[model samples]
Target chain A: MSLLAEIAVSVLIVIGASFALVGSWGLLRLPHLMARLHAPTKATTLGVGSVLLASMVYFFAIGKGVSMHELLIVLFLFLTAPISASFLARAYLRAHVAPDVLPPAGEQGWATFARRSDDAHDAPATSATRAPPQD
Target chain B: MSDAGLLDHALAFGFVAFGLALLLNLLRLVKGPTTTDRVLAVDTMVIDVIALIVLLGIRQSTQAYFEAALLFAMFGFVATVSFCRFMLRGRLVE
Candidate 1:
């Protein structure tokens, strides 16, 4: 490999590794579950995405031609990261979050908790409705 | 220093740093305040493991590990989705 290509690969690897560390740090430091969700879903995607990019570049530099398949991992992660984040957010809202801390459920009554509100008097929304306003 | 030696040193540094990140993720998984937090930590850990495996493949100059990374990604996504589904519905499939 040329010196320039080698340097590029090294730089990519270091950047990717640093981002991974930062993501994990955020996970530990963030105080709330909702806030913590942001750290892993976003930072880790960039972290591993770049590492795989480095791997792709390194292979190409060594003249075995690019490993086109590595791109699939990057693509897959990007597509699924949002799905996981949304699922986790919904799960939190339904299972643990107080609705008053949320903006008004607006017209539809927050799709995730709709069924529960109809049957249970102490359903999530009812409790939120009774609680004093949170600043 | 020779280019190969320098590259080797950099790769080693990356390995250690990522390993530390993996450990931190484990700590979060254990100490998380809620089930949602633990699930989030585990999801992040799987992604870190995937990154580490790819780096290992790079250091060894072997494409063999690529398939392993791909499989891990698939399984991790499935696990995350199933866990979320269970948390949402209280059943894996219903």
Candidate 2:
């Protein structure tokens, strides 16, 4: 492989790997579920994208022709990350979040809490551990 | 079969970093304050494993791992969606 291609592959891999590590660190250490949700979903996707891009470059530089399939992973991930994240956020809100801390969503209140008021009666699911709000 | 010296060293660094990422995910999975935290950790683990597989393919100088990596990613999404669905509605579908 050419020196330029080699350097590009190495740099991309290092960047991708470090980002993945840091994102997971954030995921593990963040104070709350909503805060944790912001961690790995975006940064690590970019990390994986860079790694895949490096693979494509390495292969093409060695004269194996451009490989397009890796892009499919990138496209699919970007499309689905937000959707899955929203689903997770909804799950977190419904299972543990108290209604008063959230802004009023009119008569319906927040969709997560179906009780429609800031009353203390809504206890959410007993089976799930409560997510403590950041103080 | 990687012949480039710098590339080889970089790949080793990547292997260590991603492996450590998996360990961190495992820590969160075990020490979750809520079920959603565990689910999120699992999702991140899947992404980390995908990166490892890609790096392995590059290191081995072969294309054999691509299909497995793609399928793993798809399964990760499906599993995450199902987890959320179950968590939100207490059921997978209407």
Candidate 3:
């Protein structure tokens, strides 16, 4: 290999490494599940894409011919990451329903248990209240 | 130093930095608070692994590394999808 080619390959590696570093940084720095999802989906995708492109270049330059394998990997990644992130975020939302949104505990138990118990005990009384006038 | 020498140095430094990044991602995978966070971290880690495989393919000048990258991509997608479905429905099977 010529000197220029070697230098180019080295430069490509460095660029790829920098992208990986930034992606990792974003993963660590982002706060909250929803916010952290953004980091890997966006930064990491591009970062890995660049590195794979560099690899494609290095291989082709070395007379390996054009490689489409990395391209396929990139396509699969682009297709899947977003769908997974959205599913997870939705799951998180469902699981984290606000406590304030729930009815008070006593009211809930009364409505759930006491109402049924009262209906069972006061069947005739309830019927009398409902009967218009069975004279 | 000659150009070959410079290139060798660059490759070494790049690999080192890439390794560091992989480690950082692994840390997130280990310590992530929620299932979603861990899944995200794992996704990022797998992407980094694919990149690393490509780098290895270049560094070693072997076509076999491409196969690994391809497999990682395929299986990683399946894994992510399954995990997401599990999180959403709380079951892997409907």
TM of chain B vs. native, candidate 2: 0.95
Chain A vs. true chain A, TM-score per model, equals: 0.82, 0.80, 0.63
RMSD of each: 3.8, 5.3, 11.8
Stretches of candidate 2 exceeding 4 Å from the true structure: A106-108, A114-135
Task: Give the TM-score (vs. native) of candidate 1.
Answer: 0.89
Candidate with more favorable, higher DockQ: 2 or 3: 2
**Candidate 1 chain A — worst ten consecutive residues by lDDT sum?**
A117-126
lDDT of candidate 1 at residue A115, scale 0 to 100: 55
TM-score of chain B of each: 0.92, 0.95, 0.85
Candidate 3 ranges with C-alpha deviation above 4 Å: A2-4, A97-135, B1-3
The clash number for model 2 is 0
Residue pairs with clashing backbones, model 3: none
Q: Kindly list the per-residue Cα lDDT of model 3 for residues A1-135, writing each as its tens digit.
A: 556666676777777677778878878887877777777777777777777777777767777788898788878777877876776675565445333343455433212112222232322121111112222
Evaluation by DockQ, superior candidate among 1 and 2: 2
Give model 2's TM-score versus the native structure.
Answer: 0.88
Interface RMSD of each: 3.6, 4.3, 9.2
Minimum summed lDDT over a 10-residue window in model 2 chain B is located at B85-94
| lDDT values for all models | 0.83, 0.85, 0.69
